[model samples]
Target: MYDVVIVGAGPAGLSAARMAAEAGLKVALIDDQPRIGGQYFRHAGVRRIGGILAPRFGRARYIHTSLSTLGRCGVEVLNEATVVEISADRTLTVAFRGSITQLQGENVVIATGARERVIPFPGWTTPGVIGAGAAQNLMKASGVLPGSRVVVVGANPLCLLAATSLLRCGVKIVAVCAPSRPRVTFNALLRLMRRPDIFLRGVGYLLMLKLYRIRMLSDYRVTDVIGDAKVTGVITRRFAEGLPPSEERLDVDLIVVNDGLLPNIELASRAGCEIEWEPSTSVWSPKRNADFETTIPHVYAVGDCVTASGVENSLLEGEIVAISIAASKDVGERGRLRRLSRLKWRWRRLQKFRSAVVELTVKESLDQRPLTDDTIVCRCEDVSLATINDALCQGVQDLNALKAETRVCMGRCQGRTCMHTVLALLATAVGKEPDQFKPPVPRLPLRPVKVGDWLKKF
Candidate 1:
């Protein structure tokens, strides 16, 4: 048994572990990835990919330092360990190297991070079309460029950053398309200025695009991807409230798209933590107290898993949760209460910037052109929008009923990619809010495991 078992090795988990360890508590940090850094910090330094942009992608020194500190402070780090289940008793069932083991933690921290929210469009499953996050991972972790020529599509600022990164790697960017209006972007910018570092990074990305003379198409949405087996190009339309939409076709080998991000709340949900729906992002997150503990006693969540705010917020939250956990043991701390107060204050202040980012990235995108009936909603099951619509029309009013009707969320992903979209459509069809409809209960064995391996564990 450990004092605390943090399920993630990203900034939040690392910080939490370090703080807990230093407070004289035995801490264990587990992550599914072979490496410690979570998505935001993974290959942050271009270890696998070497190019002119290599310096920009080099491993983050802070993460490196954090790793060393964790080791020095006697915090156990378990990489390639997937936590499949969490019990109310604070026991974690983890699968690693084809075997399963139970770990009991006096306190548990779920920092599983967030997943890329992909908005399915026609031909999105085409060979050359990829999520912006996937493209980033491919380039940074595997040293593979997503494509020679790419058109980045999304309203999120990450799209702009991805475009710039691809440009730095000598990839010819066709254009950057965002569905956001100029007015919304301007307002977001004003709010962004409160956090100058983030605001400056965004501005730098845009400036880079301008310097390259690449088109930055505002209020433009990709209506269709023009390709069969592979993406050949995309069809974009500039949408305005009153004016007729203007259509343009861009020829490109690759299409990178991002909607935004949604927190990975499956573990918490499975642990029976109460969830709260956020209207801004149209996603549910495990509810947490100011101290970061969830409704489940001694269970906590932090980082992007709580809110896809940013790395800065994640790091701060990690520290806060760790401190809060440490205080329970009557750990020696010179200014425990004072520091916690300050961190909470800083965290609350950062919410303004986070809200602005959500508004800028998601507000317009959610109002996107309705998906065509033929558009695939569930890629794994090949369930189409028409099928889901028909099911709703048949009076399938609940998530489970809809799933049973069309097998929409019953595929390999088990609704990770398609559930939000389906839920939104269902809520709209039923004339109810998303929270009014209950989401399917999260089941155990969250990740796929072989029956043979499962038997061996027993």
Candidate 2:
């Protein structure tokens, strides 16, 4: 048993563990990855790969310090431990390689982070269409180039950053395509006007594109991808009001598409935590109070797993949640809370800039292109969109009923990927607003548990 068990070793998880352990709480940090850096701090030694960009100076140093602090503070870090289930009694079932174990904790912090959102278009499943983040992971985390010539497609500030990084690593960027208008949120635009340095970074990226002569395609989308076994090229079309159909085919070895991201809320939902759906980010996240405590007592969540906020907000939330937890234990620690209050002020100040950028970049809605009847909406079970629509037309209004009829959300992913699509289709079929419809009902074994491994639980 431990005082706190953190279920991820990313920025938020690491920050929480570092703070909690420093406060003399026994901390256990578990992550499924082979390393503790998660996605943001991903590094693959000294080998340089095409399209890989180095991290920012401050971020690099902070990650180094955090890792060193973890070692010095004696926090138990399990790198490859996959948490399978969480019980109502705070019992955690984890699978580490061939072994299964049950652990208990007084407080549990979930920072499992978020996964990249990949909206399937025609031929997206072909060999070369991959998530923008997946390309970054391949080059930065694993030291392998996704492809020599890459087309970066998405609508986030990160997509631009990824393109810049890839260009720096000597990869040829065929083009950068975004479906949304090239506009920032009003608040973000105001903040950017005040911050010249941040404003210059955007200009710098454009200058780099000009220097490299890379093409920038805004108000465009990858309508169809063409390939056989491997990607040969991509088809892009402009988005105008009933514009004439003219497809621009770009020859490319790889295509990276990032729609946005969704929080990994499977475990939280299965553990019976209340979920809040945010249409702006198109994600279902846990409902937490000002103290970062979830509806379930002693369970906390921070980082991108809670919102679409980036690394800075995640770290700040970690500290805030840790301080709140500490204050709850010792109400007399006024000094600690005071210091934390100062830290929160600084965090907010820094976040004023980042929140603006995220607000400008996050995907607010699904791809408006209608799904084909033959398109597979649920990739895990190979369930077609037509089957789901058919079920919905037959009076299956609720997600549970749809699940029973079409098995759309009953696969290994546990409805994370298909829930949004299914809900949208159901709403369209039933002529109801998506929010007005019932949300997805979560089932058990939230994390993937192999049958052989699950049998050992007994």
Highest TM-score, which number? 1
lDDT of 1 by residue, 1-458 (tens): 99899999988898888888887889999999999888777784454444544535644787778878898989988899999999879999989888888899999999999998887877787889888888888877777788888999876776777888798888899888877654466766677777888778787888898999998787788888888988888999988678798999999999998888889999999999999987888779999888999999899999999888878898899999988988877884878878889988888878878888777664543336656889898999999988988999899878888888999888888899988888888889889877886566678798887788789887
Counted clashes in each candidate structure: 5, 1
- Note each model's CA RMSD in angstroms: 2.0, 2.8
Which sections of candidate 1 miss by over 4 Å? 44-53, 182-191, 362-367
Q: How far out, in Å, is residue 196 in model 1?
A: 1.7
Write down the TM-score of every candidate.
Answer: 0.95, 0.91
* lDDT scores in order: 0.84, 0.77
Q: For candidate 2, which ten residues in a row score worst on lDDT?
A: 50-59
Q: In angstroms, what RMSD does candidate 2 have relative to the true structure?
A: 2.8
